[model samples]
Target: MKSIFRLLFFVIGLSLVNAQEIATTDATTPDGVGFKSKNEFYIFGDAVVIGNNILSKDDKKAFNVLQVNNDDTKMRYVDIDRDPTTFSSSQAALKLPSDFKKIVYAGLYWSATYAYEKGSRKQQKGNYVYKGSGARSKIVNQIKFSLPNQEYQDITGEVIYDGLGSPTHLINSPYVCYADVTKLLKEAEVKSGAYTVANIKATQGYLSGGSAGGWMMYVVYQSPTDNPKYISTYHGFALVNKEEPLDITFENFKSVEKGDVKTSVVVSVLEGDSDLRGDEFAIIKQRDGSFQSLSNGARFQQNFFNSSITNNSIKNRDRLPNSENTFGFDIAKLDIPNYNNTIINNSTSETTLRLKTEADRFYLYFTAFQTEIEQTYFDDIIQDNNPNASVTAYVSPEIVRAQPESDPSYNTKEKRKAYKYTKRSLNSKAFKYLKNKKSAAIAGIEGGYYVISGVFSESLRADKWTTKLIENGLDANAFINPKNNWNYIYLLRSDTAEEAFELTEELKTNYRYRDTWVLKANLD
Candidate 1:
């Protein structure tokens, strides 16, 4: 048997772009991954706003699809351009770069083109509101393409239209169509970007005179071979844990410090255009559940992705593109070379990359890869942990002593809550919830004011911190805040803030309780 990691990473928004229909001779899709296409249906257009193209030139690097809804039931809207240079047609054609190579990936995007919502439109409904027969397909589904000699040819590949479960669209719903044009594209590849042009046109799509929208298409493709090192298969997973403004960790991600394999983090704009991905960031969570800003230093890498796109000049990854909508780059700083040693002197070993984009409007995908070679070796050792274990990141006395020591006293504004599990026993109900949340081993509980410490979204990371603290000569334990459902590194609860402050200093100065923070709760 072989290790298989199947991910639908390409699903950003707008019905996940029908990634399941992608033909791959290599790996199997894991269960509970793909979705039914018909259920994601809509008429040729819904929520028609004004736009000439599906995306502005700035949005070219990323797929621009829109969805509406609250925490539940994401409703999507797209503008499909009907062809022949009509008034403000949203139609777009992908022009290959002159030095194009094999197209490893492509997607045909169709959005709600309902041109007109005359009279009045309904606002609310049951379960979820959907298009009725009145909103059925206004145009015929006959699809055409712009190829070399022939002006328009019928596309032969299977067209998987998006969400058609509704009674009306069951007949003909707007959808994302996937046509394998590898042969056609390869034949035209030699033309040096000029010989080939592909555009989608639902030319025969007919609409009622009363209808508001009908016609055209939008398509986006990624031809990685244009660069010398192509993406054979981007092996990684998407972190959609809770959607926008998320803190995520992929356990399967492994690498050595200074390793050849680099981790890339790309956040697609489902709803933003002012800045690049990773442009504005909130530092890792603090005791009061606030974040520090990295806005000034947030970067954009010019030459990292496609140097040609930047006119051979390297663009800063954190800076917005001139086009303004599309941006992605590798976050070398966030890579965890050694899991355990991620903490040196109680400071963050792993980088936290969260965007403070206007209300955090984005989706994230992460990929890891080394060069195409037999093997790659790393000679640098930024950190090394357990002696008996492999030379990776581990917590040791040297690392602890190397950390700076400082403790702040009596600040109430931040509402910092720090807790350390005191050996003092608790009631059955509280203990049960504690167990469900998880219990960490402590050196021993003591009666003293305690300091605020670390916090983690994952139990494994929290546990490692607990162990490291205990080893470095202190009673440390993992506790769960059943309220927020987060794991934490805390100290025994203290009777007074003064005593707690004293202990905080002791731990910082003596035991290297470096990044410790306070934990809070209402006793009454």
Candidate 2:
């Protein structure tokens, strides 16, 4: 009787251990947590499946029919590079705008559903059961990563959540890990390229639900041609199904005070089916505090997690194979402000998001949100008047030119001289529009030409430089360019290009202003 009681207690304890689900938690901030920048941010990643031709072209849209772990599916390595040393690998491309100046922060994330193999299956009461004991591994957090045209390097990351360590992770046997790759990317100057991740350690055979694995890189970059934005990235492991829905609330950031506000969210999920229906992604509306389903041309409100990487209604075809359905992996960017039923606006600062499914069960590992914010400008500096000072060089010049001459050689000589001066000026400096031509609203100061001294990403730095110039008796002021959110410090503004060009040339003679250039304020 004592032995029986002991056995009962043992069973109870084991069940309790298996009942605890992995909890979602925040990753350590590589650049001080929450939202790292008020600049442009984006994400790029790919699914790491072990096999090719898993689904036929005919099964692409066969809703509720095909699955990753279907009986007829054969599991194999998805090695597009044909590297003989790696066990399994996959590649995804990353692309950023040419104007992206610097990377503020970068986080690498990789996840997989491990240990559901054919040998672990057993029949109990006419139902197949998976033990999944092989899922636990001490080296689960180690993986091989390669940048474009580079050799693979081994990297070990922090385990965000491992099902083997969770009390309730046994149901699906999953794990997610992360590493701060900001320094690596900065040193390597990785702007855009194909990234390959290998040895993810996921089972290829079959699992009770479905098999899935993937890696993602979330990056925050600074750009002189993008609006000031609040960007935040969150990482963890949680399940969303009919019985348990997930809600993630975001705060510590505010929207722009006025004008049009744009907000977006990016999500990375695993085990979502391309065919299964009933998964829903939603956000709490600020107007009514009610959940509103998010939908686009590529995603449906009732089936948001349909195993595809998308930006709004458009699908991304930047990766190798670029499969129509990633088996079960999903990464998407949803522009909330552009959605027809969106309730987010200028008044929104905090928000709550929810994910649930009635027929499909999937794991949510990563979520990121970004929104436009008011531009930060430098404070105006006061200048003291000095009677002994020389007159400013920016004064409009009087026109002085010889009248047209009858002699053909005289005209040719004048034309040649003018062309030489124009060529020399253009070759010595570069210029760009202060505002985008497509923008409807005027940007920067109300001048046709600006003699710019410097451009800065941070307003504080621009302010500091402007202060020094004012102290030195230079009539310098800074203005925010609405088109790109960059602070431009200018020494002079003129209505005519000739006046601006003359002032720029005069300033170029000074060692301190050797790089001074002209900015055309109006392209229209």
The residue-by-residue lDDT of candidate 2 on 412-454, one tens digit each, is 2344222112223433322222222221233545847777777
TM-score of 2: 0.60
lDDT of 1 by residue, 1-524 (tens): 12223321221111012223322123212211122211110001111000112222222232322221111212121223234532222222234443222332332222222322212223465442333334434332334444334344555434333323534333222233334444454455232221112232221122221111111212222221101111112211122211244432222112333324322232221222222223343334323444444321223321121111111123222221222122111222222222233211122223333443333232222222211111111101111111221221111111111111232222223443343333212343422332232112222334333354665657777788788878877677655545334465667676655445456555654334543433323321
> How many clashes (backbone atoms < 3 Å, residues ≥3 apart in a chain or on different chains) does model 1 have?
51
**For model 2, which pairs clash?**
20-167, 20-168, 38-229, 50-76, 51-76
Number of the predicted model whose lDDT against the real structure is largest: 2
lDDT for position 119 in model 2: 21
Q: Report lDDT (CA) for all predictions.
A: 0.29, 0.57
